[model samples]
Target: MAKIIEAFVDERGHLHTSPASAIVADIAAILGRVGDEGGLTSGVAALILEKRDAIEKAFADYDMLKSSGATIIDVSDRLRFQSHAE
Candidate 1:
């Protein structure tokens, strides 16, 4: 079966003190219940695998942008545009 690999977050969020293994165990339990409810575990796995590359790439791009010192301006623009669009 496919596995969820690493997780990445931007440097600003509050750090959770939970162990990584605990998080993985929680996800496994959730997926097990989802399967019991007629959700296809294999389908979920396949979809995640398919999109994994794009997801990782997007995160990496965001990290690069933050490292370049542009996140504040980027976030401001995003909020302004979203507010106007709404």
Candidate 2:
């Protein structure tokens, strides 16, 4: 059987390898090429396109919470407190 992998981002804005390491590698290569051409913004745009499904799913989860009466302020405050604690 083939192993499944996952992809995640670490603190350094680079990808951490997992099952989705191939996808991450592709994004990194594109980013590197764009960066070499002094196009960081375009590189990020490319990355967003590559990870659109994951990003959309995350946003959908957030939207569900909002529909449940959670405010953006509430989420922001919690994140701020967690950041400080970290």
Best by TM-score: 2
**Full-model lDDT for every candidate:** 0.57, 0.65
Q: Which candidate is the best by lDDT?
A: 2
> Residue 6, candidate 1: how far off, in angstroms?
25
How close is each model in CA RMSD to the real structure? 12.9, 13.1
Candidate 2 stretches with Cα past 4 Å from truth are 1-38, 71-76, 79-86
Q: List residue ranges in candidate 1 displaced over 4 A.
A: 1-42, 72-86
CA shift at 35, candidate 2, in angstroms?
9.5
lDDT of 2 by residue, 60-84 (tens): 9998998999656666588787887
Error of 1 at 24 (Å): 12
